[model samples]
Target: MAQQKPTKVMKLYNRVTRLPYGNKIFSLMVSRMAPYFGTIRPLITELRPHYCECLIKKRNAVHNHIKTVHVIAICNGLEMAMGVMAEASIPSHLRWIPKGMSLDYTAKAGSDIRCVAEVKPEQWVEGDLLVPVTAYDDNDVVVVEGHIKLWISAKPPR
Candidate 1:
């Protein structure tokens, strides 16, 4: 009998990321923490096979003394949106990761932030996946916009 592969446990940036090593887990790990991963903590709101959304609130931890949302925090949210979207846009038999992220801060985010990343894999064949991200403030005002370019590997390039 073939032995069952034990479920993998992933630490969410440090805690809570556990159970099975899927693309989502990897992306979350990569996006959430590191000396270079920035310091803002992003919360994953939706995880779908074709897209995902994440959210984070503007607090002193992610704000400047002026109470304005920090630019880096916005970047973190962008990365999460991109990562989740990319994960959804790819086939399970395939592999890929983010190559670049371009962002623009349009307005001030003075409250909770929400980032949505959507994908259409069927619309893509052989090329980069451009996941457009739009972040909104509590009042539904557009606070940031960005695009994350992901290079889909031809194979499982672990």
Candidate 2:
């Protein structure tokens, strides 16, 4: 099989990650492109093929009545990580859209949260792909765990 060209998103990430505060710049760019993700103000710390990680700071904007990070805010971070991971990992001929998500809240999100999304190399193919996601609080306790399902398909010929 021919080597797949990098997606525009992946190319952008590669270009920015080398500059000073590049991760922050990339995160801001993504938030601008997808306004909803700006709600959580996610700071992408790492992005690579099949993997992505981001941090969501604890703040009033994202806090719940209980003074903890809201579940919805955490979900937004997870989805952002998954979207970037898919963009970086998928073959050039393929495209993906999120289908659904299933999650379990494991603990209170006190303090900043680190969100991660991952997919095994073998799982990248046409059809449904389940990307595993997890969020951890500052102390490394899992606050949320789930999978985001994505429908993968061939891109239309130009």
The lDDT for every candidate, in the order shown, is: 0.66, 0.93
lDDT of 1 by residue, 28-119 (tens): 56564433333555666666545666777777989977898887788777776666555444554456667888888999888888888876
Put down candidate 2 lDDT per residue, 86-114, tens digits, no spaces. Answer: 88889877899999999999999989999
Model 2 global lDDT (CA atoms, 0 to 1): 0.93
Superposed model 1: Cα runs more than 4 Å off: 1-38, 156-158
TM-score of each: 0.70, 0.95
RMSD (Cα, Å) of model 1: 6.7
Clashes of each: 3, 0
By lDDT, the best candidate is 2
- Residue 102's lDDT within candidate 1 is 86
Instruction: Give the distance in Å from residue 94's predicted Cα in candidate 2 to where it truly belongs.
Output: 0.5
